[model samples]
Target: MSQRRQLPMPRPRELLTNSSHFFAFGFGSGFAPKAPGTVGTLVAIPVYWLIADWSLPLYALWLVVTFALGVYWCERSSKALGLHDHPGIVWDEMVGYWLTMLLAPPGWQWMLAGFVLFRLFDIAKPWPVSLADRKIHGGLGIMIDDILAAVYAWLAMQLLAYFFVG
Candidate 1:
């Protein structure tokens, strides 16, 4: 059997000194010993709440800006950490969950649904998501898979809203 290589985890001091690492780590939520991705996604919730009332155009624009910035943040952090797509680099998860919440209904239940769905797709990595994760490299590589997963989750969220919230 082949041995699996373990990726290095950054220390808290690194986060304090590096802006890119701080953001890429989801405001330090990625430092969690267990399920850093989940913790990062949770960090997105309050962010979503802060902007939940924005107009659609504004919300979409914010996603575009953040997504672009995330690419750079992840790339720089990955380089600094001497790893590719380190588990602690979770800016992708934050952006993915926000994408999944696009046009989501206003309610705690809907938010929770979006959260669960985003996490499901992110973790499952079905089809193109898995393909991207395996084939792509660099910061875009790290973010692309999660974005694809978010698309899947977004589609599921729309379907669920249509069928149940009608």
Candidate 2:
């Protein structure tokens, strides 16, 4: 048991397997019993701080790669958990929130807006987003809807920027 406890955590791998199961999961933020999506979105704030210094292109590239890979990991982990889109697999939210922030002004206002828009779009699931959420299942299903939500949030943020930001 000591050995098991001491074992290193898995790292996020782009391959079909080997993901930073816990870290990629926002330190288990996805495991919330209720409002898992809400928890997932909330956990993304600090991630933004950590990656704030990186170039936008790099951050975008990393998010894209992670989302693409998360399709499988999320599905597999969900399956393993005997649940579909378990809250514990919140890597999807992390990537999506990052996507939303990429378009923002990178300050308190933008962070606040990104948080609100991402959560709203994620929960509202308008148009094809709703369709995708209901029709799709498994990893891609979990990841895609959030991706769409992020896109919507990003657009909304851009609109706000146009109207509100200088």
Candidate 3:
């Protein structure tokens, strides 16, 4: 019988030399000692603020560009880290958080709610999100589940806004 091969763990030194590391780590947010995904998502808040005033089409363009870049670098980082869906690779979290906030109303309250909801659905991984997490591989594998989680969060945020803010 053939044995399954194991991927090697990513090293801190790779962060110094690898461009992918810069993104995969969410510009170092992934280096946090605990809850790196949460930290990465937090880091995305300022980025969201920067684009909040942009036209909807422009904002969407940026999202598409960043998501494409994320797909490439995240894949490279995964290969470098040698671990599929490594905890430290948090670009997905950053992108996912942005997606969660894309249609949310402007306010600290909405932002906080988006953050909490995104984190909840991301960690909980219900339905299609869980399915993608388990079945997909490579860059798409890393990003899809978070995207699904973002979708769930976005829907919840919209409902909350309808009832509470609208």
Candidate 4:
């Protein structure tokens, strides 16, 4: 019997050099096999918690910096990997989730809602979100849906917080 040849396993990491690279790989959360976007979004929670006390403006600053830079890094990493919007690319999840978390109660209940809502909008890509997903390409495509999802989640949170909490 002839011996079978085995292919080497692919490394989990995609080398990230700059802000774009970091966002492209979901800050390396893309390496996870299962629930990559969720994992990537989850990874962002602690960072959010750390800056939990900072002014909203500060967080906003960070968000802008990442969003502006991500357009290029995400595209580069996705192209290099030979896949467009690969599951491994979860940087969009991280930023999107963070944006969703913004303006929420920050408690378990609200945070959990935010998480679910963000995921749903992200996966479904309703309305303009779908447009962004299909019409856009490269990093913009990878991140735009998540951005819309975040916007949806944030608005939903506002409504919920007002009606449910008050």
Candidate 5:
């Protein structure tokens, strides 16, 4: 068996010095020693609460702007750390969780459902999400798979709300 190359993890000073690295790491949630993506998604809950009451247009605009910025942040952080889609770069997970909650019902139950669904899709990476993960490269590649997973989770959230939350 061939030995796989190991990428160097970013040092704390590096994260402290770089805004891109800090954000891409989900404000340090990505520093979790295990399941950083899940930790990052958990960090996003408060952010979602802060914006959940905004008008739909405003929320949509935030999503667009944040996603675009996440691309840049992830790219810069990945380059600094010399890795593509580093597990610690979880800005994508934060954004994907926000996307999953779009137009979701106002309740902790719904929020929990969105979280579970988003994590499921993100972890499973079904269909197009898996395809993107396999074929895409760089920051866009790192982000696109999560975006696809979010779409799947969003749809599932909608369906669940229609059936149960109504």
Candidate 6:
């Protein structure tokens, strides 16, 4: 049996006090005892709801900004934690989920599907995602795989939306 080694836990005080840590941890959702990535993505749902109605251009702008900043914060947090791609560094998850929902037809059903597909692709790390995860390093490494997973999930959701909901 393969056992995953846990990353050292960051204290709530440190996470809350440091802006980089706060964002890297997904506004504290990464503090969850289990599945911090899932929690972080879950935390993104409400934020998505708030902005889902915005024009596509605006949403794309937000995504770009978040991702560009993520590279920095993820790197900082990973350095502080002394772990690369720490499970607790889940800003990638939050952004990835948002990317998955971009331009998606509005509905609770589509949201749920996007969530599931995003988590699946993120965890599964198929093909290019796996390659990026294994070969890349630092914050870009951490964020790229999830972004690719988001792409996969987005495409899958689009297909499913077309076939099942069209």
Global lDDT scores for all candidate models: 0.93, 0.76, 0.85, 0.76, 0.91, 0.92
TM-score, candidate 1, is 0.94
Writing each residue's lDDT as its tens digit, candidate 6 over 103-155 gives 88888988898899999999999999999999999989989999999999999
Error of 5 at 4 (Å): 13
Better of 4 and 6 by TM-score: 6
lDDT of 1 at 139: 91
Write the residue-wise lDDT of candidate 5 on 32-133 in tens digits.
878889999999999998999999999999999989999999998899888899998999999999999999999888888889999999999999999999
Regions of model 6 farther than 4 Å from truth: 1-6
Q: Write the per-residue lDDT of candidate 2 for residues 1-166, one digit (tens) a residue.
A: 5432333333334222535456445566754656767787888888787886788789878897878788867876666556676556778887888889885776877888898999999888998899988899988898999899999999998999989876
Clashing pairs in 3: none
Residue 95, model 1, lDDT:
99
User: For candidate 3, what is the lDDT?
Assistant: 0.85
- Candidate with better lDDT, 4 vs 5: 5
- TM-score winner between candidates 2 and 4: 4
lDDT of 4 by residue, 1-166 (tens): 2111121212444353444446676667766766778888888777777765668898888888777777777788777766677777788887888888776775777767878888888888899999998888888898888899899988998899989887
Q: Which 10 consecutive positions of candidate 1 have the poorest summed lDDT?
A: 1-10
- Alpha carbon lDDT of residue 7, candidate 4? 18
Best by lDDT: 1
For all candidates, the clash counts are 0, 4, 0, 0, 0, 0
lDDT sort, best first: 1, 6, 5, 3, 4, 2
Residues 1-166 of candidate 1 have per-residue lDDT tens digits of 2122246667789889989999999999988777989999999999999998999999999999999999999999999889899888999999999999999889989889999999999999999999999999999999999999999999999999999887
Q: Which stretches of candidate 3 lie over 4 Å from their true place?
A: 1-16
